[model samples]
Target: MSRHFETAPGLCEARDTATNAYVFNQTMLRIKDPERTLDFYTRVLGMTLVKKLPFPKMEFTLYFLAAIPDSQLEQWSKDDGERLAQTFGRPAMLELTYNWGDKDKAEVNYHNGNSEPKGFGHIGFAVPDLAAACARFDSLGVTYVKRPEDGKMNNIAFIQDPDGYWIEIFSPENLEQGLSEHLGSDQDQR
Candidate 1:
């Protein structure tokens, strides 16, 4: 179905002509350093790695990490894949296959982020104690980007990784309200 729409720099959105409307469906993200990124997602964000598929020729690994719902595990195990995802991924269940290194060098997961004359704005990581996390970063000489602040958030802060990529240290709870606010209307966060 060639729906000739303005294509973003990344992959084109698949479509259906019968409805002539944008459909929300599964999103597959490709990333570099899938293992490291997967570890970060699971450890720092409390996600569980439910699946792993490695492609040596592609020098990449696909990891599916989902934040389980409060429902009984028996029920989820009995549910269909599509249903499980719909119930859980609505707010978030972002997936990725980070290649960190392909063949000799990994392909970029263009979806990661793009900065104007700079690096990614930042990716948030959940931490128990902002101060303690900051201290650890300090010990490793990770550049301090910002002191933890309320930011209208329960607690959050910014930091720069060794590669100069911006990182946000935040609690999962802090995002609940902000997310709802963004969904409410056209509020320019940027």
Candidate 2:
């Protein structure tokens, strides 16, 4: 299907489209050990150690990881356990703890075991800008596994966090000098 940036063609796209009227916020990963999982995210992926909280009367802890401050998310995390117990209906985020109380516990990860399924797998996410995001990864010394590639509908790229978690970034348009072979330009595909 043909896609255009603008809804009416000549005019600009709607305001909500910039941040996305919809976006996947958080993903709760099931880790054999939460501590090890923490290591991979903060140290490897470079997402700031955001927040952590104990699940009342349980051996588990809930962590909130994010690349930026999301105010709406803070409300969900800080709610009481009884409320959170009701909200775990989603697949990814486990719970939301109060930002003020949990920040102190967040820290960097030190890889100690085979991350495997214990940590997250290849998570594809959108960015504000595609090429700029890849450049940030480059500056952080994060190895770019697959340079950005343009699709018929989306721009994409791949990279690995320090823990060996593969991440793919997707955007609405083309990456300036992204990998082009993914298109039918590939002789094999053609």
Off by over 4 Å in 1: 1-29, 53-60, 69-75, 78-90, 100-114, 117-145, 149-155, 159-167, 171-190
Q: What is the C-alpha RMSD of each candidate to the true structure, in Å?
A: 9.1, 10.9
lDDT of 1 by residue, 1-190 (tens): 5556544356556755676643443346555555555655555445665556677887667666666544633444434565555444444445566563542454333532446555446656677666777677667555556766545443567765323445678667556655565453324433
Clashing pairs in 1: 31-97, 31-98, 31-99, 32-99, 32-100, 33-100, 101-106, 102-105, 102-106
- Per-residue lDDT of model 2, residues 1-190, tens digit only: 3345334326543455566534454654444445555665566444544446665666456676655335544544455665444343333332222223233454633332236435334666667787787787778677666776533434677776543446777664554434364444334553
Candidate topping lDDT? 1
- Minimum summed lDDT over a 10-residue window in model 1 is located at 103-112
For every model shown, what is its TM-score relative to the native structure? Answer: 0.45, 0.45
